[model samples]
Target: KMHRTVLALVNIFICGCFASPPNFILLFADDLGFGDLGCYGHPTSLTPNLNRLASGGLRFTDFYCTSPVCSPSRASLLTGRYQTRSGIYPGVLYPGSIGGLPLNETTIAEVLKPMGYATAAVGKWHLGVGPKGMYLPTNQGFDQYLGIPYSHDMGPCRNLTCFPPDIKCFGLCDVGVVTVPLMHNDVIKQQPVNFLDLERAYSDFSTNFITTSVKKKQPFFLYYPSHHTHYPQYAGPGAAGRSLRGPFGDSLFEFDTTVGNLLATLEQTGVINNTLIFFTSDNGPELMRMSRGGNSGLLKCGKGTTYEGGMREPAIAFWPGTIKPGVTHELASTLDILPTFAKLAGATLPRVQLDGVDLTGLLVNRGKSQREEMIFYPTDPSEMYGLFALRLGKYKAHFYTRGATHSGTTPDKDCPVFAVLKAHDPPLIFDLEADPSENYPLPLVGRPDLQKLLDRIMKVKAQFEASMVFGESQINKGTSPELEPCCNPSCSPKPSCCHC
Candidate 1:
């Protein structure tokens, strides 16, 4: 009888060890502002579904994107590395845009695909497109791709004017001049459709993918990168003029509905308990001309610069019976998603260094905080926005490029009015606990210890820049035939070695 019991125990252990992993559903909203959601405190905005999600699971108060833009941020999220490391430092990638994710860099989908998870990316895929080898989603790792190659607003529109009034008509608008054709794999599947209808289509595709996976009893990873609340402000037919705020708010409400529909579908299918849903934005809202849709509240600066408004985003993870609900003020980045998902899927990644660390433990444990410090940099060159900022606890330091000036104005030109002279140059430090808004800069007087902290931040910033330069150089060497002809035998010499 004792021998029989031991055999039974061994069988149970083996069964448990070979159990299937949980499915993953990552919902990424395009250009959704931090204050757009109701749970994140939008007095006029309504995000009932997302609010419910926050109540049901975890709401991260201080979550951030790696960059304040799309492509770079998405690249970082997928690879779990800084964009600079993967040569994805920039604004949105055009069809023929040169550099994308390096071939050597592995994505979360690639890691999970081998682990038996069916991966699909539905909605916006702003990484890249066209002839570039690294541009396609299929090349990256996604098994199925159904989404726009870039932002919804990238397509030709009837009106190319500013927001609030610069509304673009769908079918009436001129196509080739303003918008690019929507792509499926490498082919142009359709001309740009109405923004509202496009979203619904995205929802339908996502729902179908999830339902099919559930029916098949196969674990799947759905990357739902949405194209809501971005621009060309037009909510669907039924949702138009629903919000009191404006078209932008109306669009946000529609986005909330999409989230609701997705969640409800999961629950209805009885897969909510076995699925992990992550929701976040590509960056902070565009606070300049597109201020109608964005709300930075008390945070300083807006999109396109390394500031609270630019990088700090609304992040939440919902996995019923798994993640606990409530606010977590831990410092987290989009880069953390790759490693976190990999861990949950029980997948192994190639031996490549990634800047982000897995925060699965912190997500599961209520009291745990993941990051001690984070570095942020912008890739835009128009503003000559060569700046790096480091956040180590409360002390934050902004290191400007040699001749670059600091300014508060959105898209400011002709030398920053707020530029401080070298004599008075000092790192702007704030006690975030007391001043989350960073309204008042800390006085540099009397605190020698604080000065030392600033110095350390600068040192770290220097190291980061050096590493980026070195990586770029290596990529150049690899792509350049003159530099090394034997290195790349089939090399046709792309714009950047990083494109490989």
Candidate 2:
């Protein structure tokens, strides 16, 4: 009797130690706009699956990405720290960029690794490219990786830089001019994957990962970062010309179907109620693409600007049994994802201070948002010193003004409306609650004019300046000979690194 009791106790303890935690599927879209999804008020693009997910869970209307571009926003999403703090400050990583999310930073995957969650990173991983294994996803806590290393357009374009100055040139002259290697964990699975099949492959990888993880009885964290809707728009087979909006719309449609299938997989595994799913974008659409560029709806400018449209990404969180289905206008940023997941998984947050707060309460319908403000920075690939926008409660104050007529031409510094009366000297304030589009600006500094606002801005700026240390961006850093994949059948660089 004693032996039986001891065995029972030991079994209970072991099971308790490895009990199933909630699975997380972070479905990240590349350059998807706030107004692109049907749930977010897009008129045409078929995103039924995403809309359905939103209807089943909580949809956030005013959710923002940390930056107006990709790598910085992704870094912030993973670490719950500003890109400036995470060392990806100025720009996006390129094809063979040396620098990546610093090893010191504790990623969300790393935090959940201790809980025995099976983690996989699928699709685009613009963080870094490698001959060195350290920059790959496996080293960064992901158990498996199957995807492209950077933006798809980075491959050789037949036309000028593969941007295709004319829409007619798309898929004709310059699409997939350069070959992007298909990475499977640290090895190059395919020398150059056909762009036409990219979307379907990503979907297959994701669902397979989930299926395998479930079979192993392991809770999983699947980071599916789609590589569509950026530029050089190529539609995967069966998705071509499917949307009325052209290639961009086709990509959206494919993504929606992919989401639906993923949800279906979760349901099939009998873990739909235990899985936490998130659908959001790295940033807004690329307006430079003109007709091919996505509309930001009522929001100001598109990607690369600090306007609402640039930073405000469409976001949806779904956990069938946990989150109540409702739309939240509360201010939320991708930065909050880390701490929220930490709390959900009962994982330890890093000892260092973090920018994001725990949003588990809001997720559970327990309380209002703990976040009240957010700071907007200048566009990357430009001079750093430019206008900064501060959002305090309902009022958004811009210390400097830029003549942002459209997406790309926003000036590097504050633009002058007059010869002497500099518009930004007193700061231009807008009531975002009244004007979500940021059309009209309240008159410059008046009696008690933004004194509190100025004080708050100064305080945060001072703190940032005091502690912030800028890291060298690896953008366009020449691909080192050592970073090249070992193509020889008999030779391997390192067993842990990439082997062709």
Per-candidate TM-scores read 0.82, 0.85
Q: Residue 467 of candidate 1: its Cα lDDT?
A: 55
| TM-score of candidate 2 on Cα atoms, chains taken together | 0.85
- lDDT by residue (1-500, candidate 1, tens digit) is 99655544543342233245778888888767677778888888877888898998899888888887788888888888877667765455654444556667798889889867888888778776534335668888887787767766654465532232334543333232224445555555555444546667777878888898889888899998877766656677656778887877877777788888888889889888778889998887765434454776666655666667777889998887777777888888888888888777666765887777778777776656667778767644212343466788766665542112222344433113343322115766767778876556688689798778777777776665565531341122223212211112254442122111
Cα deviation of 444, candidate 2, in Å: 4.5
Candidate 2 Cα deviation (angstroms), residue 156: 1.5
What ranges in model 2 sit over 4 Å off?
Answer: 1-19, 159-178, 381-387, 401-406, 409-423, 444-450, 463-467, 471-500
Q: Lowest summed lDDT over 10 consecutive residues: which window, candidate 2?
A: 412-421
Predictions: Cα RMSD each: 7.6, 6.2
Best TM-score goes to which candidate? 2
Local distance difference test, each candidate? 0.67, 0.73
